[model samples]
Target: MTTHCDFGASLNDYLRDRLVSGIRSESAKQKLLSEASLTFEQATKIVLSMEQAEKSAAALSIGRPERIHQMSSVVARRGRFDNGAQHSKTHSQTARSDNAGAAWRGAGGTAKV
Candidate 1:
């Protein structure tokens, strides 16, 4: 059978309501527990969490991204890349025979493999 229908409420709200109804069923509870490797208590929590996450996703998707940006602060970092610059090494950090003084270099030692 084929069917098409739209909910009067948001998609997330509809999904959440459906999840609540399914979670109330014994078969749904057992399936959730076995499939998800969860206890009855955990199944209930997981169902509720999925419902809430869908609701939040729907809320975010339906709203304009720009308006949401104004509601929160976002910080980003960008580094300056200098093609011609050479990094100076400190005098005391020269490579040592014992490999103790050098931090970043691979110890030129034999591998068992």
Candidate 2:
């Protein structure tokens, strides 16, 4: 499971460092940081958006526009107002294997149940 804060802080550091060292642009870094500082969660969201944008950019650069679009659609669908995607299982399937009914003892393919 990924946390918004963990990856967000990492990304924030990354983009800031890259822009500062690689481009030597204080204005750009300040602008980005300021824009993302409007709310408490804005920074994390901006970081996540930048990460995803870079991923899509890489995919397009590699000539896989369809894959980027497909992945985007999946994200959009998952972002919709629903939690219907779930792991399916029956009641019996939920039992712990160690505590369940015993299996047949077999010397070969044939065995007594």
Candidate 3:
């Protein structure tokens, strides 16, 4: 037969260890207790939920599809901008002409004759 004894260390030590191990933060634990008014078991469940979410996100990014898509989109958009600059020159001339008309109207329709 064996007897079990509770460790004399404060609960904070356990919480710090869990947080440092990427399980949950001390602030999060406190928020669960104070803000959420959750019991210890409920707080543990919340912490586990957060941990699972983090794991799931990490798993999703392991393939790096999102990062690859972002990089490709950036490259494609840059290419489009470079190609569109030539087209933009003509459009800008038309825009300036429109702006001049607007300015003429704003100046009480007095033509620059």
Candidate 4:
């Protein structure tokens, strides 16, 4: 209706009413309707705010678990790496101790401290 015709003085009211009625969200519609007087600009602002809030909520709901999963996987990998490092360190110490023992035995147990 706005494309082909002009409402002149009633244009703002008509646009505001049309926007309030055309929205799919019942909560937004109710909020808009509760207002005694609302302009088209006000309605658009309310709708945009509501839409952004909903999008934010949806992104958090979907993204939070994935972020947790990624963090957990990183922790798991770090744990495995730490365990492997510990094992390698123990093996290296054992090999050094064994070499020292061999050196002592090769000296007929008379190696100086």
Each prediction's TM-score against the native? 0.28, 0.28, 0.45, 0.51
Better of 3 and 4 by lDDT: 4
TM-score, model 2 to reference: 0.28
Evaluate model 3: give its TM-score. Answer: 0.45
Return whichever of 2 and 4 wins on lDDT: 4
RMSD of 4: 14.7
Judging by lDDT against the true structure, name the best candidate: 4
Tens-digit lDDT track of model 2 for 52-91: 7778988768957778899789879887554777666776
Between which residue pairs do clashes occur in model 3? none
Tell me the spans in candidate 4 whose CA falls farther than 4 Å from its real position. 1-6, 63-113
Pick by TM-score: which candidate is best?
A: 4
Ranking by TM-score: 4, 3, 1, 2
Better of 1 and 4 by lDDT: 4
lDDT of 4 by residue, 20-39 (tens): 88999999898888876788
Residue 81 error, candidate 4, Å? 30
Q: What is the lDDT of residue 34 in candidate 4?
A: 80
Off by over 4 Å in 1: 1-37, 64-113
Give lDDT for model 1: 0.54
- How many backbone clashes are present in model 1? 0
Least lDDT summed over 10 consecutive residues: which range in candidate 3?
1-10
